[model samples]
Target chain A: MAQITFEDLSLSFRVRKGGKIGWKDFIVQGLRGKGQDDDWLTVNPLRNINLSITRGERVGILGNNGAGKSTMLKVLAGIYPPTVGKRTIEGTISSLFDLSLGFEYDATGWENIRYRGFLQGETPKSIEAKIDDIAEFTELGEFLDMPLRYYSAGMVVRLGFAIATSAMPEIFIVDEVLSAGDAAFQEKAKKRMNKMMDTASLVVLVSHDMSLLGEFCTRVLWMDKGRIKEDGPAKKVIAQYLEESRQQQAA
Target chain B: MTKAIAATSDYFTQIWQMRYFWLSLVIKDLRTRYRGSVIGMGWSLLHPIAMTAVFCLVYTTLFDVSLIEYAPFVLSGMTLWGFFMTVTHEASQTFLISQAYLRQNPAPLAIYPLRTTLCGSFHFLLAMLVLFVYTWVVQGFGNLTAFGYLLSSLVLLFVIGWSMACCCGILNVLFQDTQHLLQVFMQMMFYCSPVFYYPEMVEKRGMGWLVDINPFAACMELIRAPVLRSEAPEIQSVLFAGGFALVLLCTATCLLARYQRRLIFHL
Candidate 1:
């Protein structure tokens, strides 16, 4: 029973005016008093998000840049706690965002597989069991023996994707990682994702690729300014989203 | 009370469950730190040994202290101080160093500080071994029973180091100047502490209160009593060190609880 519920959730954080005040400025500000609000900007990345997601649903999120798609995904992944209201989740979650961010550049690909696998909650015995399968999927052959710093961007993405998707999680969350690799890798990645979607109890994805969403998602959520603008069948919602974007461009 | 206990136990369980992840990271840190160096891990030992040699020469020649007595004393003090310095300095950068992992996975925030402390402990233990062998060669191990107390003192120091790292790591993330501020503060502390000089020198100069209030001074006494004089650490020093460790652990826990989820945004 995989479920996710967000009830009137909102997240806001204060950003200092000059990128973090120094100790001296902090003291001066304390002494001056009262007008310190001028030195902070409150950013509301999410606001009053009310939604529920259940098992066996392949959902795609559609939004423009800074539309809170990634922020919502992060909240769903439990990376960010809401500032107001509540977020409740059940079942194990595996998120595949920022794929290229966490690799140890000094460690070789084989070592990275172990490191990333451990982070994904795989035990040593479990990782050893699946190591060969993950290695085969990446197709980097001799390159896996070399340190990650020497690998090209595309190669790193392949390794990251392969290791990340190895876990059989109850819920899968992804964010715009499919745009990086070459065409052949993309095709293979799609096949792998389709296979994962079949077994995964629920899947939530954020991508700008409407055609990809139309093909893979049963439902689509169109987000605008931290709120869900439209939620409907994949084809219908993506059509409305595309229609609005086309109208704006023509205007 | 039960709920709090359950939550605390749950937190520890989460940390225990992710042992492989953090442990592997600690090993990777240790490996990369010495990878290209010709002397490799010996570099950690050489730093304290070299400083001890220089201090021994100056003290024996100018201060008219006996080499046999002063060498082990200064060496042990330098080794302990080195551990304290390394742990706090590196801990301040722990969050930034693991920023990538923090963004990717939601492991317990304390593990990052633990990683830094474990690395520092490796060096500390290695240096302690050197001090042990040096003491045995010079004075033939004065009090065998006193050596048992070192075990408890090491545990206390480890707890203190971990807590300090946690607090410093979180503070550094919030205020980017924390590491710099800490460096200047530590410099002041080094002079205030009896790192190279005798603890009695401060007392003779009518400033025994400095030793009485200084937690580092208490720590020095804990290590020095057993290693230098072959006497068990006084109960007062032990209690002070233990009490200080508890206070810091509480502070670190509270800070982590408040900032664990929010710290990601700042990073």
Candidate 2:
């Protein structure tokens, strides 16, 4: 069985139209248009998309804003089912999408890590035994006893990263969290990810860093307008993508 | 059938994976709720006390009802009602508030709502302890045996709270106005249930059945009997309430699991 597959997946979100319709537009359309009035409303955030991911493969998804990178991650994580399509995911999975998703800011770092680690599928006994290791990795050390709200954004990212990745899963799904954090933490994160690559059966990462994509991923998936434009070796696909982007800029 | 099997396995796996997270959530929820300045968690007790005071004044002074005969009456109803209302409000919003967590881990969405309801009930245990102390000090612990009935009533309230929370939690995701709507519903229910007035106070013509259908009324009747030195609650009512709660919980769990992921888009 494949580790993950999204067949003709479609997920859309409806945002309530803000503000009253302008009177000027209403009157102008009424005068110029001949068709009946329409009350249908809402905008779709994600459209039909199809993709496949298999085991022992590191697939990297790249796309511009609103191009559906995050949406794809959510779908893969089962946070949002495809509005239309069949999805089959085999084995246990973990997500490192956003840092404050499960952590309670009002609680201490010790508490947040335990809660977050648990949410990520770590047992209490395991978490308790590894708290010191996680705490050391985060370098937040003594501050772990303090409320998370008191910590800076960098601190939050470090702790979140440590807790989430602490327990390796069969499949790990990470969003654009790498773009965050300071230089030192980023280096540490890369090193941690390198360690993960050694043990994880499959790792699906979404990042904007083409250079990093080349360094980590065996294959690259370039998404455009909710569809895969290229799915090939990291270096070749990223080079082609960059060339196309440059040409579009020039034009 | 395959989907169901897969889903069940995933649900159990999620439960195992997120057990620590849920336990931590419970602690965080309880700690944050009452961790502020003075009173601390004692305010958990204070809430029921203040509610009891309000009912005392409303029933005795305003309506000319007798508390001397009804002190236990108001205490039992309000305490149990407080537990029910608190759990309902908390559980109803559990998923909505934990959107961040839900968006990250697609495990059993039912766990979040259920965990919250359990947390709310835990606080109710504290408030129940206070009720025992208050009534004992005031009336001299007459029928300690009523503790059995009290225990059963609390369990009944837990069932109602858990079921209602699951229903409301799912509904609130679809409709943002559910919280406000529930507030109004609870207010109406407050007046409808025999919270302040005895069931006998109302003309017993056709409304007896109304009290039966109202789960809160059933809970109060059960609790009030033991506390007021009345007989044990009717076995039929207890069984009905317990059965009703179980059905609601199962239904809510199923719906939540089915719609768990879809909720992200709706939110």
Candidate 3:
């Protein structure tokens, strides 16, 4: 069974003044007898998160910008390890974030499909079996023969969405990838996401669309400044979240 | 101990499971490197071949050696040196180049270095084939038994290359100046090592100690003994290179284990 558990989880980043230090500064810092850690500013994106997500739950997260919603999803997706606590997860995880990021611009769309397939843990034979289906879903018939560099932004998203959602994931984690492409593609993408969510064992999604969350999620988590402010049924928590935001606007 | 072994094996298994992914990346690199070029991969060979020609012209006259022997010798040395330079230099950027994939998927970090090593090795192999044919034309085949040793040497060299790539890649990610530092260091190493001259020349110049301590000198001997002299590599040279490889492998493993989880922050 797919399960996720976070025990007292907290994550903090140590940011240097510059992104990196040069050798001259390193030697000077060493000779100055000042501790290296003193130069770093720590930013904590997650603090004291204790939660368990079991199988077969469609959970949605609602948070303002910088409220740690994406960070929580990344932690869940195993992209980041908790700094001071334990995170235990069972089952395969397929994360859909940065959907248009990792393509080889020189490679054709058909070849890119194979590349993405292999990255998602599909064998050659398996990808071959599903290649036709993914291609059909993209609706880019002759365009799939051209290199990715030649495709428009919308076409790239279409191809990315099709290949990413090709296989059913055991634990699917999505972050703000729904509102991609044109109006027609968004409608198709929603249908495809709904179909995948129906079969996926568990899914945790982060989105700004409260109506979308209300329609898809059974449970909702309202995050505020690195903490879960409220957790309840989707309707109740989203309603409360909207009410708070409205009050803040009025104030 | 058993737990350690299990973890090691599990790590390798994860790398193996992603073979298709990394292999595809390697293929893409090779394809794009020569795409739309008329000469194709010969472009990679041309640098060493041209360098060898120039060196042969200058060095044969200076040392009064025959062109036939010096040509293959310099070519072979240049080939191995080219491999070392390509792998370590390109591997330093492996993590940065694959940053997108790293953020998207949690695959083994070692595979990025492996991809760089494989690409470098492919070029090295092609260069070696040219060296073999040139040697055959000029001096016929070397000892078949000695040629067999080249196989083992290649394997050792591959491991060393991968380890160096891993170390350099991780270091470059953590320290932005690492690649520049490495370039300066490698330039000094090229001059110090017997890339264009014989190791015996260093000994004649009272630099015997340098030859004894230099791993690259030992590696040169390892390749030269089999191809030039038609003899097996001396056990001492093999042991020295092997010991260096072991040290580098351990260092790479330790670095990866310590930084694998935390590297994303640096990136």
Candidate 4:
């Protein structure tokens, strides 16, 4: 059983509190041994939350900016370790959170596909098998030979989306990457994502689009200020979340 | 204590599983360096060639040093020094530059340093081969036993470069001052270590302790002895190099294990 379990998982990051961060000042304070003078602010992005995600579950995370939604997804992706609890995961994980995750601007578009695919833990042979499909899907043609530095923002996103969706991942994670391309590619992207969602054992999605959540996920977690405010069926949790947002805006 | 042990073992296990990633990244790094350049792959040999010309002019011509003897001496040392410079230069920025990949997933922290070292070692091997062949044609090839010592010395230097990068790479990430500090340190080490000058020259000045104690001289003796001096490197120097390399690599591994997870926050 490929499952994700979190027991009282929490993560906090330390930040230099006094104004803007500068390496010059940090070195001076460090040399003087005045650690106290450099005020450190600890910010907990994930707090005392117990959650379990099992196989065949598509969980959508909804939250306002800085509400720990991305943090939760990142923790699930193994990008951040828990500060005060335990998290046990069983599965091969793939993240599509950043469009240019392992992209090198100096590398050609074809090269980036392999680079991104390798970063996702795909073997060279496996990625090579899908390179032709990925190339055709991106509609890049001769442009694939050019370095990514010359690629347009739309072209970069297309290349990223094409490569990310090329392989079947056991546990797929996405954050705002589906909105990468233009309207036409967006429709195609949604269709491809639906197929990936159907095939993947576990899909942990973080998105602000309520309609997308309702369409893709059966369960949704609404987070506020580092804690889950509501967790239920997608439609119901989203309804309550929108109502609260409306109330907060109106007041 | 057990927790630390567990983390260390898990760290190595994670890296072992991702061998392909580290290797491919190394290849990608090297390919990118000389990709569009005119000479292309030949660029790897250019560093040692150019340095040899300048050093040959200065030492043999200006200082009245013999061309036959000194040519091989300076060429070998400069090649090793080139490896040291390039590895440290690239290693300091390893973490900072890999921030994109690091943010995407829980990538192993050690891969970044390995990327620099592997890329550097590849270029070093190519550069050294060219230098060695050129030296052989000019002056006869040294004895076979000295070649074995040179091989071990090369291995020691490689480790020394890598371990320095590991410690400095993380420190560079945490405190930006480490990058600048490393540059100044490398410049000082270049003059302090016998890169352009002979170790015996320093020894004659009653500063034999400098060559004996310094790890760089020990590493240099491997390349210089059989290839240049045509003598086997002293066992004491070889032992000192092995011990120094062991200490450096251990410190680097321990530093990485302790702060591997916390590195993401710092990044």
Candidate 5:
């Protein structure tokens, strides 16, 4: 059975026109201005994105900025409901879309880890037992006791990644978080990701790192202008995406 | 329809999971607010005490209301008023202040303001501790009758705080200027609420109609009456606040569920 399915999902955002119109019409104009001749318009952020991933498939989404990679990931993670389609998801989902989202900067790293762990439904006893392991993974050392506000950006990323990856979720969605850390932390995160991949029923990663995608993903989805430009085996599809990017740049 | 049901269940489960995160956030918020101060958490009590002193001098010395009642009356009403204003003002800014947390993680948006409200409530708890000490020293700790009302008022304040937190939480997200607007509004509300002055004074001055409309005025009376006059809050006013809270909770849930995805985009 497919672990996740997104069927013809589409989302459009209104691009408001400038200047005012009629008082009554202005409010009624929905997305933008009313009868001032500028009217209104909408732009599709995600358009007809249909996909189905079976259990244990490591799929990487590749696109330039504004290509809807993040939006699609959010859709799959159930953060955004599609305007025009359906999503069928199975199993528990845990996503690390934005690295520093759940952490309290005033708290010690240890406290943040426990907090994030609990937010992902880990028991206090379980989180307590795993705190040492989580700290060791991040290599934050004694600084873990200090408030996260005092830590550097790289340290925040490392701690965030460590806490997020603590739980072995059934469906794991990683969105551009791996790009933040130092090389050593990156390698550690990569190892952790690989370990997760072995057990994760569905693993979806959205990133611009085509080379990394080539190295890790079994399949690649190339998105362009909110549409799937290509989907196939990782190397072949990514090559087409690169060619398309080059041609578009030349044009 | 089925998806909505599933999502509703998921929402509750998410809140359950995020409970610890919210608790930690409250602790962090409280610690950071008073971190570098020499007195630390004592500032919570000091703020109310200082405000009461200033108001006492102005209202009692300048005006005659303070003369009618001495320290106990002033302290009792001021304590409750301080709690109400502090909680409302803090909770109103909760969403705007915690933008970092709300944007970065998938934690429920409701939790951010909830943390602020909880932290504010916790501070109020600390202040109540100080209030008891002061009252004990002055009045000899003989008011067993008032404890029930005090407890009941505390519970009402909490319920009201949580309710306002949820409403103001979403409003702050939707309207960026809500925090600033609320600050000014709360300042205006303080004067109109009969906090330093008695409700009877407002009634005598032919502004009883104002008290009828002012929710915070009723809330303060609810708290003060129990503590000072040993009377329960008006059942009607309590019901009104409870109903208003229910409405706010429903509205917050709807806004949170609907626009929660777009909150990042707006930010």
Candidate 6:
């Protein structure tokens, strides 16, 4: 069974005044003797977040810009280690934040599928089994043999979506990826995602589309300023969040 | 890779499971390296061969050494030196170049260096073939009996390359300036090592201990002495190079285990 827990998780980043200062900056700082720990500011992206997610749960994270929706998903994806808390995630995790991360532009579409599979932590044997299915779903025909550089935006999106969704991940984290692809393909992609959500052990999705979240998520987390403002049934939280944000905007 | 990493055994298992990831990365490295070129991957073979030829012609004439004698010497020296140079030079970029994979996939921290080493080793093995063909044509098949020694040298060179890659990959990830500093160090190392000339010349000048003290020098002779002249490498040289790499590997492992998860912050 899939399980995820966060115990007071917090993530902080150090920003420099003049931008990413390297060794030269440190040397200059030493020579000038003007350094007093004054140029560094700690930015907290996630603040004291605590939650537990078990198998058969579909949760939607709704938040404004910089409210830590992506940060929380990244934490679960093992991209960022928490600064002052503990996290335990049990099961296979497949993150879909930036689907084209490991794609090579110069490589042919077919070669990229293998490369992408490797980056996704799938063995070659398994990826081989899924190649025909991905090829058919992408519908790229001759383009699959051609370099990805020649592919159009919609074509790339279809490829990315097909490759990412082909595997049955025990824990799936989706962040703004479903927003891509053409209309016809987007509908097809949504159907595939909904099917996966029906059977997947745990799913966490971050999106701004209210209807999509309401249609898919059983629970909702409303975040404001890096903290959860509301957590309850999907419809109730979405209703309250929508009314509060509407009133705030009107004011 | 999400398994408990406290035990030594788990480390091996995690790395083993991730072998396909590293192998595919190496293949891609070789593929994209010469994608839009006429000569293509032939450059790998042409590179060290041209360097060895030019260096041999210039240096042997300047030193008044016989072409027949110095050819084997330069061939063996540069072949091993090429491995060392390519690895140490490219090691810094191993992590920086693969930042995408590192961010997306949390496999073993060792994968970066190991992949770079495998890529370099493929080139290194190709250049070794150049040496063997040249030797067979000019020097005859007599010294081919020492082929066993060449195998040992290849193993030792790989260990040294892996160590440098590990040692440099971490530092480069933390400090972007480390790559520039490493470029300078590798240039200095190239000149100081016995790649272009004979160690006997250094010894004749009463700087004999320089070869003994310089790990690069010892590593050069590990291949040069055995494959070129068919003599056993100094036991001390093998021990010194092995011990040095072992120390670096231990340090790299410790630092990687401690800071592996934190590396994303710096990148």
Rate residue B224 of model 5 by lDDT. 59
- What lDDT score is found at residue B171 in candidate 2? 76
Q: List DockQ, one per candidate, in order.
A: 0.71, 0.44, 0.72, 0.55, 0.36, 0.59
Please give, as one word, the docking class of candidate 6. Answer: medium
**Candidate 6 lDDT by residue in tens digits, A1-251:** 79999999888988665565556776788888875379988789888989999988889999787899988888999888899899999988877776556677878899888877777767888999999999999989999999888887678878877877788778888886676667688679778767776775688999898888898889999988888889999999999989988999999
Per-residue lDDT of model 5, residues A47-155, tens digit only? 8888889888889999899998988887787666577988899987777777557677778888888877876778878899888888998898999999888998888
Per-residue lDDT tens digits for candidate 5, residues B221-260, read 6665655555677876677666666666677678778766
DockQ of candidate 4 compared with the true complex: 0.55
Determine which window of 10 residues in candidate 5 chain A has minimal summed lDDT.
Answer: A18-27
Interface RMSD for candidates 1 onward, in order? 1.2, 5.6, 1.2, 2.5, 5.2, 1.9
Select the stronger candidate by TM-score from 4 and 5.
4
Off by more than 4 A, model 5: A15-41, A149-153, A249-251, B1-14, B65-68, B234-265
Chain B TM-score, structure 4: 0.90
Residue-level lDDT of model 4, residues A42-122, one tens digit each, is 899999989998888889999999999988988988888899999999887777776656688888898888878877777
* Candidate 4 total steric clashes: 0
Query: Which 10 consecutive residues of model 1 chain B have the lowest summed lDDT?
Result: B138-147
Residue A184 CA displacement from its true place in model 1, Å = 2.0
Ranking by TM-score: 1, 3, 6, 4, 5, 2
Better of 3 and 4 by lDDT: 3
lDDT of 2 by residue, A12-58 (tens): 65543543333354567678876424533544445555666777788
Q: How many steric overlaps does candidate 3 have?
A: 0
In order of appearance, the predictions have TM-scores of 0.97, 0.86, 0.97, 0.92, 0.87, 0.93
